[model samples]
Target: MLAAGSGAVPPVVWVPVVAWCVAWQASLQHEVIHGHPTPSVSFNRWIAGPPLALWLSYDRYRATHLQHHVDERLTDPLDDPESFYVTERDWQAAGPVGRLVLWSLNTLVGRLVLGPPWTVVRFALSEARAVWRGDPTRRRDWIRHGVATALVAIVIDLGFGVPLWLYALAVVWPATSLMLLRSFAEHRLAADPAHRSAIVESSGPLAWLFLSNNLHALHHERPGLPWFVLPKIYRANRETVLERNGGYRLSGYAEVARRWLVTPRDHPRHPGRAS
Candidate 1:
């Protein structure tokens, strides 16, 4: 940011750089939720505090993500907060426009271009509803995240001498898009829990940016392991992990894009969850 402000690096260049930083920050926040690099819960929490998240609060994400780890409920449309699929009731409630939007979101191109804004709006509304329902925890989290986002905005405008709109367009949106890439088809609804999560063997810069979450199945299988060690462990247990997950793997994000860019991978409605 300083480089960009000082005109040392062009804004065009810094845009992607800042975006990558924010996206990597999210992966670090993921580590925080899982108790990584330290044993002290307080330390872990504060260490990765303030996700600079334009959408969800850290506490809110933490609570829901922990619940999402329950293997039995991996793709439970109603139960999993991160689930891409929706229940039949949810589909019916969406009407037509909402249904079409859901359909678009399931495609790779749509997810890259449209997912961030949709997630922001949807999650904000959900959080606001929770606050209206007298959830004090949600209230506090919202307030804190609101303050944090404001501080970041200030830094961008005042300290860095960059326009707020530029910051959002350059930094925030791209970061969210990058995250969407990793999560695009990250999981599938399967009878076996192990088969639900996917392995994206993309060892490119994104692998590091995502903190090795490309090895997602291993992360799920050993939630306690730190990101740095995932590759080593996965390599050692490759056959076993592959067998366990029933070969739920992909080559990389490139493959994901090739396969699902225009076509939807699956319907928005969850299979076997219609009732």
Candidate 2:
């Protein structure tokens, strides 16, 4: 907060540093949801601190992501809360503009450019509907999320000298986009439950940003293991990991970009249930 607020901070470094912090907080949120640094889930959440992503509800994410770990439900459009695919019924229900938007999101370029806002808007609308329906859980989630995000804004905007708008654009948006890159191809549609998750063999800075989750298949296989140990464990059982995931591996995010930047990574429609 201080670096970006301070006039003396590096011109280029402030944006990325702040952005990395936001993204790191998001990774921390994921870790907290997975029961990290403590046995108490509530304490872990407080330690995870403010909702840096601003648009998301950590409570809601916790509920959904735990559900996402059900391997059999891995990429099921109807079951996986985080599934990128849509059911044939929904696809057929969507009009031309909506279909085009879904098609664009299937590409890495469009995911980077459009995913965050789309996610935020869709999430907000869903939450609004839930609130309207008098869902107490959604009400509490958003209430807490809103207050926490406001606290973050106050600390950055008022306590420090940074503007919320600038922070949202430079830090939050890029942070969200970076997050999308990690998730962009983390899973694939596969018949075998083990093969649904993918492995990205990247040990660089981005891996740290994702808390070593770039070794994704292993993370799914051993979600209880702490992030720091994932690499060591993965190395020890590299061949087994490869075999378990049916060799669904990528060299790195660079390869992901090379393959799917413009090309659609997969149909937005879940092929197994497609019309």
Candidate 3:
């Protein structure tokens, strides 16, 4: 169907078929990060290294995401590099518009609407600075990422004859939507590290869609456990995990949307940031 849409055959009857392909590819990348589909790390990386998620490199994401499993300081502003909330120091460093952007990004709606532009631009500029500073490893990662991105561009241009902007709208935009839903209510910067992760219980369709990432606390506790095994482990150890997490819970994404659709879950201030 997607091949047909790419003009390989004829335009298929399905509109969302391509969107589902993009989403599945993103999920495959997530699995690869956890060292699944095979034990050979190189093979796994090769399988997941496509620029389907755009600016993020699989190697860099794997490194950072593994570090995020450091349960002692899961959402600490200084420790967790993946943290979205800005520290007080960071907020002070930014000017007025920057601060406003930061605050807006803390909410789900803002994150979805503005996140792609913010992330791509910020990362590109940061990488440029790192290269200018002669950071060897950063340069290497960026080079690899650029190569992958170029290949993606060539495929779209040659294979589909689709303009870059149209390709982004077709592929990147929907993929970002799925990614946003996965990370939407995954964490909170609580005082205790165990309590940092949020459980979106009774997730129906999205459970498989997110690769059972809704059972986030279980993943944090046992990062080595495979995605297929997460549901089993979560069910067996539900009480213990919840007890450790101080009973923090939401009924599901629907409840999450209802409660925090308009409200901000956390402020621009990092919970751990000190004056």
Q: For each candidate in the order shown, give its overall lDDT on alpha carbons.
A: 0.86, 0.87, 0.73
TM-score of 1: 0.94
What TM-score would candidate 2 get against the native?
0.93
User: Per-residue CA lDDT of candidate 1, range 120-220, in tens?
Assistant: 88777877888999999988988888888788778878998888887777788889999889988789978889899999988989999999988988889
- Per-model TM-score, in order, reads 0.94, 0.93, 0.88
How many times do residue backbones clash in model 1?
A: 0
RMSD of each: 1.6, 1.8, 2.7
After superposition on all CA atoms, how large is the RMSD of candidate 2? 1.8
How big is the positional error of residue 7 in model 2, measured in Å on the Cα after superposition? 3.3
Q: Which stretches of candidate 1 lie over 4 Å from their true place?
A: 6-8
Q: Compared with the true structure, what per-residue lDDT tens digits does model 3 show for residues 115-153?
A: 767766765776578689998987888788889889987
Clashes of each: 0, 0, 0
Best by lDDT: 2
Q: Model 2 residue 59 lDDT?
A: 89
Pairs clashing in candidate 1? none
| True-structure Cα RMSD, model 1 | 1.6
User: Candidate 1 — worst ten consecutive residues by lDDT sum?
Assistant: 49-58
Best by TM-score: 1
